[model samples]
Target: MKYTDTELEKTLNELGKATYAGEVDVVDKVMNRLKEAENKEKFSIQKERKVRWTIGTMSLAAASVALLLFIGNSSSSQAQNENDGMAKFISEIYNRQSQADVVYYTPDYIDILLGIEGMDENI
Candidate 1:
């Protein structure tokens, strides 16, 4: 299928003088196809960008929700810990109340209990 130099020169000279008068709309057809392909390419690129943006936004929202849930759980656990401590404190108060005969010693009673004889004279 290789052309000799003389054949190549003759083909080029013919192409230079040739006109598409018999196929009047060939140029328009080619241009229309090119335009359609360009539009499809542009739409494809735009659609791809939209998909990427949507995925990114959704991922950010999901991460934000996860972070909020984690913070809420930690705060709830801290509150539960405080509530447990408060319940223990309340139980201790009830136990103290139930010991009705528990005596509080003044300084003199402490000295008597400790067998210190000169505490009265010191007072």
Candidate 2:
């Protein structure tokens, strides 16, 4: 399996010489073995290619689903944020109206009395 190029070339050269010297049977056997090896290699390569293609397609589908889910979740969160903003705005307006009503209805004498009481307490 680990033969160098030089060693392989030497072996092929020896086989060629043997075939030329009337060793027909040996040449036939060697050729048959080479053909079998080539057929086996071709089958193995095809099997590997099929497995790789299946894995690649499945990975692509998974990635696409993940991307879609991420986008959907992001849009949902954005919508929730917009709703939260609207709720906060409405709450602030209600608070401001309540405060204005309190200030308008409260008498000046009550305010003066409260301020004096607060000053006395601080002192």
Using Cα atoms with residue i matched to residue i, what is each candidate's TM-score against the true structure?
Answer: 0.52, 0.58
Per-residue lDDT of candidate 2, residues 57-94 (tens digit): 99999999999999999999999999898788667655
As for model 1, its CA RMSD to the true structure in angstroms is 10.2
Poorest stretch of ten by lDDT in candidate 2? 105-114
Give lDDT for model 2: 0.79
Candidate 2 Cα errors over 4 Å, as ranges: 1-24, 102-123
Q: Highest TM-score: which candidate?
A: 2
Question: Mind sharing the TM-score for model 1?
Answer: 0.52
Best by lDDT: 1
